[model samples]
Target: MDRDDETSSTPPAPAAPARASRSRQLRLAALLLLLVVVVAATVRVVVATGPPTWDELRERAGLTNRDRLIIGVKDDQPGVAQKLENGAFEGFDIDIAYMIAEDLGFDAPEVTLLSIESEDRARRQARDADGSFVTVDLVVASYSITEQRRDQGVTFSFPYLETEQSVLTLASDPRQVASLRDLERAKVCTLGTSTSEQRLREAGANPIGRNRISQCIQALYDGEVDAVTTDAAILAGFVGPRPPGELPPATKLLRPKELRHWDIGAESAEKWGVNTGPVPEMRDLVNLSLQQSAKGPDGDRWKAAFDRYLASEQQYSNPQQVAVGRQPEPEETVEVRQWPWERWALPSPGRPRSGVPSAARAPSRRNRRSSGC
Candidate 1:
């Protein structure tokens, strides 16, 4: 074969360095993808998990029976929940809070109520006054348990009370905008990032978002917004159906006369979600309380709380349209981890590890011994 023909027939071999570089690039790309997946999975798990266990939190705070649990509560909400003129907290939520604490072995006086605006309820389990990483042990501020909220790292106990979405407008408004549709280009006010805000957006209304329900109330009273919308029970608390504190402004609900139901926030009906941080065990305890609160010598804690606060609220439906009533204890018992320096049983003796490790796994150093010579 001629030299030219031989050269064309045997094409040049790719450079070794180039091949190695291409292989390294592929491996790096794979590693990057794997890292992204791992991080995303970790984030999802963390978001789903509740705050520290109740015992752990108690220990961290050096809490005792003498140490009152700082509970997050809404002060502006009237009969449903509010700080009274006498400086004591009142309402249905306040009663529920005391009941939960009582179930956890704390007396009513052993609990402390922290005034929380509706907007700050989501952050109930957050930093404390000392700039310490702490959150409220329980949140009872008309907080709802929704899939959207659950996705946002807010852990909720089972529902204790149910409410419906409704609208609130000035009693003297010329527009008389009552229903959701009544709000055309008219501005509506609500706590920012709330279910009510989302629903209003969906309902095609101009929303005047505020940081707190107090702000929303002020906006409604000032006519900056034509109406304020939220849970019917909340609306009931606002209007004089059942007053919370001194009436802020005269407000009335806009509802269809035929349908006693109005589902805002795409909520089937509003239900109270006792919020905690990533305290899974606390959640379990709270759920157990719900189960047994109506069963024992405590005289059915829930019924007691209902009689104390909810019974008088004129807005709640008759006998209540409850999705949950007198929850029964789980057939299986949960481990009562009452201390921080304790461990929970793993699903299997040798299972793959997950979640962010609290510490790095140390390599074992074996000591070698020489037999006698």
Candidate 2:
């Protein structure tokens, strides 16, 4: 009869054990909430004072706030160099660089000219270790793309211009020299350490190397070398009619079938070129600038400058120019510090193929005399 009362009186000893387990679980939950709060606060602090990337500092420190951009250029061609004069820096390469800088917020960039020789470009770029010269952000020289250069840690951008290799020969020569094989019997001269020389060697031409293109041209003129082998662009500048007797009438530029294909592009690399370190972000930024310049106003401006210089050489009149592209518009205004061509006397148009030359001359009657030559 007392069994129910006895069970009730014993009470549940297991209840005390259950309450103790619940208390332990609650303590663990509170500890986990505290840890989560600490982690959130730490992340917020880190986000507020973000770590600076090497590229951000390098670009900001090197590039000033005043829209000043310094570019490297070769000092040889007057026409091309002239574009960089006056605030314009307007050559194809110069225009491209200026446009990139402008798009990056450096409008009216202050261009500081750096002289780069065809041979010494690699070495000069390698001079970053010594800190003797200011590191050039970009090089706008008429640089060619080559495989040997790729090994030197220089990266190349997409090609913006195409050119060919050709021989600038005496018009009097009757020999039908059209390919590198033809050069086996011909004495060929080229600038030392030039891509022309490299290509010739690759083709088994075995040409004599001169110090510069001017010297190579002179060697050809003196009969020391049968022909001057170089990029057609440079040869065009040399053979095109100059202010009267500057170039002889007998000098004729010939682009043989074999030595007729090269491309011009920007160069940079991981160690020696534009990319000196492991900063992919910087490389990307520079590449973007180059691409923008190639597409927009900068591209147009560069084409005009390139055309103006090339036109003076009369290179664009040939079939190759037609094959590649048309000349840039002449009416376009280009920026420059001074008009270098203003004082030079340009030859009056020879009788046009028809009456067009004469008609064109009529309009330039005052312009020719007023050119301040």
Among all candidates shown, the one with the greatest lDDT: 1
Off by over 4 Å in 2: 1-61, 64-69, 78-91, 100-109, 125-135, 243-282, 296-299, 311-317, 326-373
Residue-by-residue lDDT tens digits, candidate 1, 1-373: 9999998999687799999999999999999999999989976775457344445544543443445677887766655566544466556677677766655556665666777656567788434546554467778788877888889888888777776666666655555443576676779887776677777777789887876665666666665777777776655544433323332322232331211222333346677778865766667666655655544344355664455444444434332221233332343443333222233332111112232121221111111110000
Candidate 2 residue-wise lDDT, 22-96, digit = tens: 998999999999999998897677555654332353355454344455556544332333222222222334444
Clashes of each: 9, 5
Which of the numbered candidates is closest to the native, going by highest TM-score?
1
Look at candidate 1 and tell me the lDDT of residue 146.
88
Q: What local lDDT score does residue 89 receive in model 1, on the 0 to 100 scale?
A: 58
> What is the lDDT for 220 in model 1?
65
Pairs of residues clashing in candidate 2: 85-337, 86-336, 86-337, 155-268, 268-274
